[model samples]
Target: KKRGVQTGLIRTLESALVWVFEQFPGTEAALNDLLTQESGPESLLIGKGSEAEMARALG
Candidate 1:
Protein backbone atom coordinates (compact mmCIF):
# COMPACT_ATOMS: atom_id res chain seq x y z
CA LYS A 1 0.00 0.00 0.00
CA LYS A 2 1.02 3.54 -0.50
CA ARG A 3 2.27 5.40 2.53
CA GLY A 4 -0.78 7.68 2.45
CA VAL A 5 -3.21 4.78 2.54
CA GLN A 6 -1.23 3.14 5.30
CA THR A 7 -1.33 6.33 7.28
CA GLY A 8 -5.05 6.75 6.70
CA LEU A 9 -5.82 3.19 7.75
CA ILE A 10 -3.73 3.58 10.87
CA ARG A 11 -5.47 6.81 11.78
CA THR A 12 -8.92 5.33 11.18
CA LEU A 13 -8.16 2.32 13.35
CA GLU A 14 -6.72 4.53 16.04
CA SER A 15 -9.78 6.76 15.98
CA ALA A 16 -11.95 3.69 16.26
CA LEU A 17 -9.86 2.61 19.23
CA VAL A 18 -10.34 5.92 20.94
CA TRP A 19 -14.06 5.80 20.31
CA VAL A 20 -14.33 2.29 21.68
CA PHE A 21 -12.42 3.25 24.78
CA GLU A 22 -14.67 6.22 25.37
CA GLN A 23 -17.69 3.93 25.07
CA PHE A 24 -16.29 1.82 27.91
CA PRO A 25 -16.22 2.38 31.62
CA GLY A 26 -13.93 4.68 33.65
CA THR A 27 -11.34 6.01 31.23
CA GLU A 28 -9.90 9.43 31.52
CA ALA A 29 -11.77 11.35 28.84
CA ALA A 30 -8.98 13.85 28.92
CA LEU A 31 -6.39 11.18 28.29
CA ASN A 32 -8.53 9.22 25.85
CA ASP A 33 -9.02 12.54 24.14
CA LEU A 34 -5.31 12.56 23.67
CA LEU A 35 -5.51 9.43 21.52
CA THR A 36 -5.89 11.38 18.31
CA GLN A 37 -4.09 14.44 19.47
CA GLU A 38 -1.67 14.11 16.60
CA SER A 39 -2.22 13.25 12.98
CA GLY A 40 -0.37 10.76 10.72
CA PRO A 41 0.72 7.12 10.69
CA GLU A 42 -0.05 6.15 14.24
CA SER A 43 -2.27 3.70 16.04
CA LEU A 44 -3.36 3.37 19.66
CA LEU A 45 -0.77 0.65 20.26
CA ILE A 46 -3.65 -1.28 21.80
CA GLY A 47 -3.64 -4.65 23.48
CA LYS A 48 -4.95 -7.89 21.96
CA GLY A 49 -8.40 -7.35 23.40
CA SER A 50 -8.79 -4.00 21.77
CA GLU A 51 -7.23 -5.30 18.58
CA ALA A 52 -9.77 -8.14 18.42
CA GLU A 53 -12.57 -5.78 19.20
CA MET A 54 -11.38 -3.45 16.49
CA ALA A 55 -11.26 -6.30 14.01
CA ARG A 56 -14.81 -7.27 14.90
CA ALA A 57 -15.91 -3.70 14.63
CA LEU A 58 -14.35 -3.40 11.20
CA GLY A 59 -15.83 -6.68 10.06
Candidate 2:
Protein backbone atom coordinates (compact mmCIF):
# COMPACT_ATOMS: atom_id res chain seq x y z
CA LYS A 1 0.00 0.00 0.00
CA LYS A 2 2.57 2.52 1.06
CA ARG A 3 4.96 1.28 -1.60
CA GLY A 4 2.29 1.64 -4.24
CA VAL A 5 1.52 5.18 -3.13
CA GLN A 6 5.19 6.08 -3.22
CA THR A 7 5.52 4.64 -6.68
CA GLY A 8 2.54 6.64 -7.85
CA LEU A 9 4.00 9.81 -6.41
CA ILE A 10 7.28 9.16 -8.19
CA ARG A 11 5.42 8.65 -11.44
CA THR A 12 3.47 11.87 -10.96
CA LEU A 13 6.63 13.85 -10.28
CA GLU A 14 8.33 12.31 -13.31
CA SER A 15 5.37 13.22 -15.51
CA ALA A 16 5.36 16.76 -14.17
CA LEU A 17 9.08 17.18 -14.82
CA VAL A 18 8.76 15.73 -18.30
CA TRP A 19 5.86 18.05 -19.06
CA VAL A 20 7.96 20.98 -17.90
CA PHE A 21 10.85 19.99 -20.12
CA GLU A 22 8.60 19.49 -23.11
CA GLN A 23 6.82 22.80 -22.68
CA PHE A 24 10.04 24.77 -22.26
CA PRO A 25 13.12 23.48 -23.99
CA GLY A 26 15.32 25.95 -22.12
CA THR A 27 14.01 24.81 -18.77
CA GLU A 28 16.99 22.56 -18.12
CA ALA A 29 19.38 25.47 -17.93
CA ALA A 30 16.97 27.53 -15.91
CA LEU A 31 16.44 24.67 -13.49
CA ASN A 32 20.19 24.34 -13.10
CA ASP A 33 20.41 28.04 -12.39
CA LEU A 34 17.63 27.72 -9.83
CA LEU A 35 19.48 24.91 -8.11
CA THR A 36 22.57 27.04 -7.89
CA GLN A 37 20.59 29.93 -6.46
CA GLU A 38 18.13 28.18 -4.18
CA SER A 39 18.72 26.11 -1.07
CA GLY A 40 17.26 22.90 -2.48
CA PRO A 41 14.86 21.45 -5.02
CA GLU A 42 11.70 22.03 -3.06
CA SER A 43 8.32 21.02 -4.48
CA LEU A 44 7.56 22.81 -7.74
CA LEU A 45 3.82 22.70 -7.11
CA ILE A 46 3.77 25.95 -5.17
CA GLY A 47 0.92 28.03 -6.58
CA LYS A 48 -2.65 26.92 -7.20
CA GLY A 49 -1.27 23.54 -8.31
CA SER A 50 -1.53 24.66 -11.90
CA GLU A 51 0.67 24.22 -14.96
CA ALA A 52 1.51 27.91 -14.85
CA GLU A 53 3.05 27.50 -11.43
CA MET A 54 5.05 24.53 -12.65
CA ALA A 55 6.27 26.52 -15.64
CA ARG A 56 7.16 29.42 -13.38
CA ALA A 57 9.30 27.13 -11.27
CA LEU A 58 10.97 25.63 -14.32
CA GLY A 59 11.48 28.78 -16.30
Candidate 3:
Protein backbone atom coordinates (compact mmCIF):
# COMPACT_ATOMS: atom_id res chain seq x y z
CA LYS A 1 0.00 0.00 0.00
CA LYS A 2 2.80 2.41 0.78
CA ARG A 3 4.50 1.63 -2.49
CA GLY A 4 1.23 2.22 -4.33
CA VAL A 5 0.82 5.64 -2.75
CA GLN A 6 4.37 6.55 -3.65
CA THR A 7 3.93 5.42 -7.23
CA GLY A 8 0.72 7.40 -7.59
CA LEU A 9 2.41 10.53 -6.32
CA ILE A 10 5.18 10.04 -8.85
CA ARG A 11 2.74 9.63 -11.72
CA THR A 12 0.80 12.71 -10.68
CA LEU A 13 3.94 14.81 -10.38
CA GLU A 14 5.21 13.55 -13.72
CA SER A 15 1.94 14.51 -15.40
CA ALA A 16 2.08 17.96 -13.88
CA LEU A 17 5.64 18.45 -15.09
CA VAL A 18 4.70 17.35 -18.60
CA TRP A 19 1.86 19.84 -18.63
CA VAL A 20 4.14 22.63 -17.48
CA PHE A 21 6.68 21.81 -20.17
CA GLU A 22 3.95 21.70 -22.76
CA GLN A 23 2.58 25.08 -21.73
CA PHE A 24 5.99 26.73 -22.05
CA PRO A 25 7.52 25.89 -25.38
CA GLY A 26 11.27 25.26 -25.88
CA THR A 27 11.61 23.87 -22.34
CA GLU A 28 10.28 20.45 -23.30
CA ALA A 29 13.65 18.79 -23.90
CA ALA A 30 15.25 20.44 -20.94
CA LEU A 31 12.38 19.68 -18.62
CA ASN A 32 12.11 16.10 -19.87
CA ASP A 33 15.80 15.46 -19.31
CA LEU A 34 15.81 17.25 -15.98
CA LEU A 35 12.76 15.41 -14.79
CA THR A 36 14.51 12.10 -15.35
CA GLN A 37 17.82 13.15 -13.79
CA GLU A 38 18.97 13.07 -10.17
CA SER A 39 18.41 16.83 -9.79
CA GLY A 40 14.71 16.46 -10.66
CA PRO A 41 11.70 16.34 -8.34
CA GLU A 42 10.90 12.87 -9.71
CA SER A 43 13.96 11.52 -7.94
CA LEU A 44 12.24 12.24 -4.65
CA LEU A 45 9.17 10.64 -3.14
CA ILE A 46 6.98 12.91 -1.05
CA GLY A 47 3.89 12.00 0.95
CA LYS A 48 0.75 12.60 -1.05
CA GLY A 49 -1.57 14.18 1.53
CA SER A 50 1.02 16.67 2.71
CA GLU A 51 1.76 17.82 -0.82
CA ALA A 52 -1.96 18.24 -1.51
CA GLU A 53 -2.42 20.30 1.64
CA MET A 54 0.55 22.43 0.70
CA ALA A 55 -0.86 23.01 -2.78
CA ARG A 56 -4.24 24.05 -1.36
CA ALA A 57 -2.66 26.40 1.11
CA LEU A 58 -0.50 27.96 -1.57
CA GLY A 59 -3.56 28.53 -3.73
Ranking by TM-score: 2, 3, 1
User: What lDDT tens digits, residue by residue, belong to model 1 across residues 1-59?
Assistant: 44456547888988987786668644545344545467311544535347656444333
**Per-model TM values vs. the true structure:** 0.33, 0.49, 0.38
- Which residue pairs in candidate 2 have backbone atoms (N, alpha carbon, C) closer than 3 angstroms, thus clashing? none
Clashing pairs in 1: none
Global local distance difference test of model 2: 0.70
Superposing every Cα of model 3 onto the true structure, what RMSD results?
8.3
Models sorted by lDDT, best on top = 2, 3, 1
lDDT of each: 0.54, 0.70, 0.58
Query: On lDDT, who's better, 2 or 3?
Result: 2
Cα-lDDT of candidate 1: 0.54
| Residue 50 in model 1: lDDT | 74
Instruction: Choose the strongest candidate by TM-score.
Output: 2
What C-alpha lDDT does candidate 3 achieve relative to the native structure?
0.58
Alpha carbon deviation, residue 29, candidate 3 (Å): 1.9
At residue 26, what lDDT does model 1 achieve?
Answer: 41
Q: Give me the candidate number with maximum lDDT.
A: 2
Q: Which ten residues in a row have the lowest lDDT in candidate 2?
A: 40-49
